[model samples]
Target chain A: MQQRTILSTIEGHAAADPARVFCRFQTGAGTEAIGYADLLRRAEGFAGAFAAAGIGRQDTVIVILQHRPELLYGFFGAMRLGAVPAFMPFPSPKQDHALFWSSHRKLLALTGIRFILTYRAIAAGIDEHFTGLDVRVLYVEDILEGLAAGTVPPAPPAPAIAPEDVAFLQHSSGTTGLKKGVMLSHAAVLRQIDRYAGVLGFGPGDVVVSWLPLYHDMGLISCLMMTAVTGAELVCMDAFEWVRRPTMLLDAIEQHRGTFAYLPNFAFLHIARAARPGQRWDLGSLRALVNCSEPCKPQSFDAFLAAFGDCGIGRGTLQVCYAMAENVFAVSQTTPGQPVASLDLDVEALESEARIVPAAPGRDSRQVLSCGRPLPGAEVRILDGAGGDAAPDLAGQIAIRTDCLFTGYNHLPELTAEKLVDGWYRTGDLGFLHAGELYVLGRQDDLMIVYGRNYYAHNIEEVVTACDGIAPGRVVAFAVESRQMGTREAVVLLEPDGTREAAELRRAVKARVFDVLGLTLQHVEVVPRNSLVKSTAGKISRDQNRRRYMEERAGNG
Target chain B: MADEESFREVAQAIGETLMVDPATITRATTADDVNGWDSVTHSMLVMEIERRLGIQLPMDKVFDLADVGELVDLVAAARSAG
Candidate 1:
């Protein structure tokens, strides 16, 4: 499909149906909505205000704000003026604002953001982070005020946009710490929107209900951008609000007759657990409830069906998508209305035999959920550790080659070169292909998934080593498989510097990590100074430490 | 709790779930007062209390309980009504 600009699509839909509701969102007041015509007006008003603020066509603006209508107006308006919008999440509750500010400073210095769009209160909170930056702040309230006051330059000339022009920068890590902007061109995003949306059978008639954070790729591209491009109705809520009121999501879906939504695995469990007795929602209106951004748990599907099946949710409604910011949005998604195919793998075969064999009904079966086939124009392959193609049913590193692939990392060329080989991007994910469907296992790298958030082992180690009693450069953090939670649990094993009590050391380490990263440690083992093993080069080995810990636990059992 | 005496028992269970010091937790303790008391843990805490007390606090009214005292009263009310 030949596509040039994102605005053209939005404009086309607006021209066709000016009165059609484009999106709906919750505010402190209550539920509010904007029609296509109103959206075009607000977006244009934002672009005009941006132009009045002297924002140039090729500028990069970091759009950080709470989940609100201004998020769209600012983002789309920036794009309208041919400025690239890089979305970052707001300073969420419980988040370490100082760390966020420091990292964002590093990122802004690297990317050279020309402008920032955010609230005054949010700006004040992180004002020190951008203390001396040349970047100008574009407050949301100021823009709205300008529009209201009729001071914004009306009808700012829309810049000539090219398909090859950078559309936006996206970060892969959902929960946020390190910021690596994956630069995507308009062509790539357009291709992704067409192909991914087509396969999912998204049309103007379908309404989207989501509480996924706007900074997240799954929420940004799959839900907001796609729905906007298609002129489909969207019912939205902020991530912070959703965390407090998850059932409100179902309430919106039932109230709006929402046909589609997507969430991570942990959310499925959250919703199921949050359900009150006798509370019912019309979930049957949903044609597909895509599980993505994290490993899709087969058991969560069972739990969801058991909890909400009475609401008319079908077996096929729960689907899985293997996606990343590097690929614009989705590499693959299960066919809508088809039960996500799963395999009960033999655990012994998974290790000893190195083959994925069908599990026997007895003791050692691992139920693995299939993430499904590649989207049109996308190619997925399993590569063994040696870089050669892996045999079917053999788990290996997942890689993708697609037209929608990002150009490269924003400022880290070496990092981009490390992951993108030839044309195929090494996903750092491990999975196997079976029956033309992909079953994602976990990350091949030491990236740990805890409570559905990605945290690198190296980063965790950095935090652990900085603790009071922990020895520097003698820390190892890894994830142990947590069968009960349907995801891995992060565990840390570090050498104490002195004769401090182990329990105290553990508590201090855990508290420091929690304070810095909000990561709750499942296990914090303070081993003897030299108990942890090292490589021949004397570098601490996380894999070896993890193995030893597991063995000790097994022996105790 | 309506009995007021059951407040300590309820407070202890909530504190255990959130890994917070129960003594620090008062009738005005909100979810934000404790670390790790976000959505995931909050739901777990609510479910745990429901299971332990054999009372069903209205999920819709969950946000109404600003602290341990209000939560106790709500739980106790639900129990007595049931």
Candidate 2:
């Protein structure tokens, strides 16, 4: 059953136990599941159609399906044809169509993805955007019917897939509006599934329950791919449905007797905050509740433990991990079946000097969570300003050299060269090594993580400028930490000319930005154009604006 | 445009929910013309209006609603027809 390629690993599982249920999800009427054999057969059927329509090796297919069961079929079906599939999140019901089209147009043109595989719901509006680009659009629902009628295809043999061939493309959300597509090969992906699963102690008996979006690294690799390769059962739920009612996660786990689930820190805090009185969950069945994808907050940990303490969810079940898509998935994850590692560091040194020192009583101290040691064959280094390995106590840029490093950015070789150096990928995250453990600080750049999703400052600023009446390109947006929200929230600062009411302008900026990004606005301040601090390059600096906003808020309080 | 009575009542409710000037929300208050009519608040706005008016609004109907005027007309139609 040991295999290196993702295709062979799933095939092996099916070869051993055809009827073994791999993925289960909620349907409109009830629950639906696909056994390993059924999955392979269905994937082959979909692949037959892909082959019939001239969609096979050497083609990059764009997949933008929702969290329905069809998403799984679309992904593996493309893979069955040896075609590389790149996933993009399904457009939100509330998304602004114009902005959505323009943003993705750049991605499509860059990656040269000519085939877009989507369902009927999103295919209608998005189809309009793909015209004039010489792209081919394929609808999944239509193809499935074509297969039933035996009119559209004759299934072709699975092509010979190489281990070093690019399996999929993962997009990295950079600090600005530029989303870089990271190309991961089959070997790199298989290596991650083996290394990370071993380190996390995932075995066949374990069952995974996840509601993360399939387009994301955590959702696609850790939750779906790893679980499949490990032969563990999975209970998949729709990400949109899960967010509307986070408690449904706990409810699903109890119903399915699920033993494992992974989420970002915000989901933990949100679930705790959103819990209603008199509601109960039998969380004792959970053996591992991993927190990843975002910075682990000590506040979130305490809040979650305190709230879920009533539901028989004990300590030592929660774990945190630090990961990025550039490495295919997990760089370092905490040991499973253990409580989160907490450390108290001197706040002054952490903030001012980027040093980690034991906190003394009566001195300013802060608590941070540990993200564990590097996986086997994975090297982690905290490179100081001089590009040398930093001391254990000193914080610097987090860098990694792993066997599972991505091949390169899809077509932007210059960007690829800038990120990867001497077989090492320079992760933009900043952290320090202590006691042979990784304690990641926040990102070194202006990129902010809200609700476990990356939102860039300038990206929000771009949307803000598009609003009427406010001066375009004179807007500054930044992430402001709100104690009330328990996470960072987007704040848009508009430089208006005093013609518009400050209150009205603030509301307008907040509404329009949210319309574009689906992020709830924390605060919006209208100041004179002269007040904004410009960088040496004559652009408004997010760091300076954020600093000024925090100081002014403190003064006002 | 909605009826005068429905317009005034729904306008006040929309203004209160969005924390804006009650007098400003009128028939011509389009999403672009207003600041707080962004996507995240659009759902909340619909939910609030539905709750206050005691009428359920299908989100599909929202796709066609461009301004406060459209929202008021839809609410009036739903109330009258139901």
Which model scores highest in DockQ? 1
On residues A1-557, what C-alpha lDDT tens digit does candidate 2 reach at each position? Answer: 23367888888899998889988877444678888787888888888878887897958887888777777777888888889887877767766655665567766776677887877655557657766786778888888898789876766877788899899887766411267878999999988888988887777777889988877898888888887888888898877656555777898899888888888887886677556667788988787788888788878777888889777676678888888889998888788777777789899988899988889998898888999888898999899988899887799999999999999988889988988989889998999877778888888877888767888776777777877768657788888765544566677777886668877777677666655566656667788877888899998888888898889878966
TM-score of 2: 0.86
Q: Write the per-residue lDDT of candidate 1 for residues A213-284, one digit (tens) a residue.
A: 777788888888889887798888877567666688899999999999998887887788778888899887
Query: What is the Å distance of residue A252 in model 1 from its true position?
Result: 1.2
Give the whole-model CA lDDT for all candidates, comma-separated.
0.80, 0.78
- The local lDDT score (0 to 100) that residue A418 gets in candidate 1 is 90
At residue A33, give the lDDT of candidate 1. Answer: 83
What level of docking quality does candidate 1 show? incorrect
Assess each model's interface with DockQ, reporting 2 decimals per model: 0.23, 0.10
Q: TM-score: which candidate is best? A: 1
- lDDT at residue B76 of model 2 (Cα atoms): 81
In candidate 2, stretches whose alpha carbon ends up further than 4 angstroms from where it belongs are: A1-3, A125-128, A174-177, A466-468, A497-520, A535-538, B1-82
Model 2: clashing residue pairs?
A507-B35, A508-B35, A511-B38, A515-B39
